[model samples]
Target: GRNEKISAEARDAILARGEELGQALAERLPEVEQLLAMPGADQIEVGKKLRGQAQPLIDEHYRTVLRLKPRLAPIKAAVFPLKRNHDQLVATAKEVRRRLQLGSEMRTVYDDTGAIGKLYRRQDEIGTPFCITVDFDTIGQGKDPALAGTVTVRDRDTMAQERVPIAELESYLRDKLRG
Candidate 1:
């Protein structure tokens, strides 16, 4: 193989780009260190940055948390069935919640009363980050065969839903809450 040397201009440009990156990192290093230390003031700032959810809740018990991240919420996740009256759905929901509690050791709730919308609102009011629903698809009743043995995870802030395999539910939630 033949060796080629860079032009002086190209070399200088590379050096300048390296310097810029180094300076940017140096300026941000202290901020990163402070966040790692997480003092009261820094924690407050972080809380503010993490609280992206809108709307207001009248419950004073969680009003302070309404300004913080879902990870900071007392109840990290809630499990429910799409239809509370369905016995199989309710049982699966309870087992799923219990498994999450044992697997992650996080605060998890099971709700079988009222509509799914109402259940979500109640969990959101308490600052819960995730709501996992055991729907008909999860129990192999849906047309999609691949959906069996999976649950729907709903994000509290965005209300976005995603299919997650029941076997991986604990780890999936653990990674999400870590942020």
Candidate 2:
């Protein structure tokens, strides 16, 4: 059976707990402390280690998707308008993508070639870490006025989503990539 999907906050908490445990162990063992202070695995080694990590998600023997984490994913984020017919949404998506790319190392793309599902599947297959969807709420046209300036961020692995303010998107994604 598939594992229960966890939210970003939950994952962060779990990581923090693990770090605490590792630190406690390090304090009791000198060797562990030295290892903890040492640098991490090199990019090539990490790449080689993660080479076989990419997985395909299958659903009902019909749909399949490639999975990757930020470390392995070339494209970090994907921006898309809720509907191609909506001029404002399309413009917002483009603007969001532009903002995400300016002076940043993040690789972002604006996609509207087909339905949202198909677009998501393409991103998943290509190992995109996250997807940002600009919808009516983001443009202040939806029922919720408070959701303006926020986009829906979807995690490709867990398929979990959260509403994130556009202003903090870059930092948010950067932190995720680091971890």
Candidate 3:
């Protein structure tokens, strides 16, 4: 399910971007043709301008488009239990990862082998955009009832943490990735 959906979305996005590129070049075709129809000196001047300015713009545009692609994203998110010892927390984390995978085509990972800090670092090294940690708070074992069913979502680049309810986690991640 995820494999097919992700691959299809990836294909469609690439094709759409490619079409956009083609249209962009087509829009400039008339101008290029007019420049080429001029005298040899004018043609040389136009070529110089294109090489110095237009080519760099096109290259940058393509790079930006490529970077924005979701399929190219290594891991959509990482899931970790606060510690490996707690069976319940670990199970919750696994379920969270499973639910996220079901909701979208993005890749999800579950890790319960290390300390939370180390897990976060590993995820960062692997280029994961977000890390979700399930702790006692997630299972209503904590004093704060308000934190029940919520996980700590950490940003890879920023290392920022936000508490997000399990029910909304997938949609929140999708929105964050989209933006």
Candidate 4:
């Protein structure tokens, strides 16, 4: 849903900007026939001067394009929760990787012995810089599993884990990914 919304917003902004630019260019440089064969050649000369002066306006418009369409830009960050079930985690991870455009192939390990260690190894093999494991601690505190609001994020390179609240997952991932 986020991906779809972002893409739509980006496309609309780009199309609107393109239309504006096209209109400006058409007004500035009319068809060659219109410019050379029109009755008022003197007016054409004035139009050319006016168009030259509008160049600055075009530049200004381009500068503010980001403000008009922010969703289409490259993602600044991403967050993923590693579920216990191998299939679920793999599926979720694949989706996150796809959404982030990471371009890495997904790999799975069948052995549960030292699973966390295996995950760390896989992360290194795939060049993933960070991994987050959603475990019992995340859903603890005598709360319902559905109500759990915490996750354990691990740095692939450092093998360090940190407890982060689920509510901050997006921003947290954004910051880590940006880094």
Candidate 5:
């Protein structure tokens, strides 16, 4: 499925560019030719020199194209129960994850173990953009009755928390992820 999803033409283009770079380097650098003429010549120094010379090219490519690569994004979002001790919180979190799966093809992870902070860090390490925590407020056990049927949505980058109603969670997430 992964291979089917990847564009063969794009891969070929990348390979072609790499070949061009190698040819250009071999032509411009006399040391490369000398290394080829000699027996058992180490290419490590050549590699380092090439890397040094190609730094600008690599940076430009990453800035203009490679930064947008979707494969870099491992997880779209992670769903978490505030505490594993509570059955209702765990159920709500699972339901939220299920609903997210139904809404989009985005990857979602359900984590229920460890403290909420550690879970958030784990999701962050995986490059998860958002985290939905189903806490007591999600099921009307909070100080504010208005928070019922709402989950605490945390942004991975900013570490900002916002209460989002469960009904609008799917569209809300889709909108945030669109750009």
Candidate 6:
């Protein structure tokens, strides 16, 4: 099951950091505007420059929070079946949620291709970068656990899917989420 206490702390830290950064950006809006209007660079160049300047602030915030407590980062990915008729999908989602103690923030995508887009949007909104989906292809052709093997793990940022053995799912997710 989800660890309520740890999850709450993590959520609080993420929100607090976001608010702090928002306020800092607001205060610097004038300078940022000035920088944008200063030179011959195009909008894309200006954006790149701004992003370079902004990266350190983001890094600092991330480092501080992670250093303070690492478990606060929410689930970086989620997997659900497209069809509601599949009990496997529901069961997987429930288990994942319970294990992560994710509360109600986890999203379910009813369409396979659409899942990538939805996951990306959510990741942008919440600063996550990965999502996974278990489909018919994942279970192979067997109903038995011994026969059922690899699962499809999707990368949110790259939109890549690889067939990973079922036994490696948990550890793989942990490593990806940690990284």
Q: Which candidate's TM-score is highest?
A: 2
Model 6 quality (TM-score): 0.41
Each prediction's whole-model lDDT (CA): 0.71, 0.73, 0.70, 0.45, 0.70, 0.48
lDDT of 2 by residue, 30-97 (tens): 43333233333112232222222211211212345566668678889999999999999999999999
Candidate 1 per-residue C-alpha lDDT over 1-179 given as tens digits, one digit per residue, 9 for 90 to 100 = 11135344544444344344345543444433333343232223222332221112212223332434867788889999999888899899999999989887699999878888778778877788999999999999998989999999998877799999999999999899888
Q: Arrange candidates by lDDT, highest first: which order?
A: 2, 1, 5, 3, 6, 4
List the candidate numbers ranked by TM-score, top first. 2, 1, 3, 5, 6, 4
**Alpha-carbon shift of residue 127 in model 1 (angstroms):** 0.4
Give lDDT: candidate 3, residue 7.
48
Name model 6 segments beyond 4 Å from true: 1-72, 96-120, 141-147
lDDT of 5 by residue, 1-179 (tens): 11333355544444444446577663444433433333222223433444566654543332321122223466777899988989898888999999998778878889987888778767766677888999888989988888999998998666799999999998888778875
Q: Write the per-residue lDDT of candidate 4 for residues 84-152, one digit (tens) a residue.
A: 465554454444445434432222222223456455554455455555555554545335565365666
Give stretches of model 1 more than 4 Å off: 1-67
C-alpha TM-scores of all predictions: 0.62, 0.65, 0.60, 0.36, 0.60, 0.41
lDDT of 2 at 12: 48
Q: Pick the candidate with the highest lDDT.
A: 2
- Model 3: CA > 4 A from native: 1-71
Query: At residue 133, what lDDT does model 3 achieve?
Result: 89
Higher-scoring candidate on lDDT, 4 or 6: 6
Clashing pairs in 6: 2-101
User: Candidate 6: global Cα-lDDT?
Assistant: 0.48
In candidate 3, where is summed lDDT lowest over 10 consecutive residues?
A: 60-69
lDDT of model number 4:
0.45
**Candidate 4: regions farther than 4 A off:** 1-114, 141-148
lDDT of 3 by residue, 120-150 (tens): 7676666777889898999999989999999
* Candidate 5: worst-modelled 10 consecutive residues by lDDT: 62-71
Per-residue lDDT of 152 in model 4: 67
Give one clash count per candidate, in the order shown: 0, 0, 0, 0, 0, 1
Q: Give the lowest summed-lDDT range of ten residues in model 6.
A: 62-71
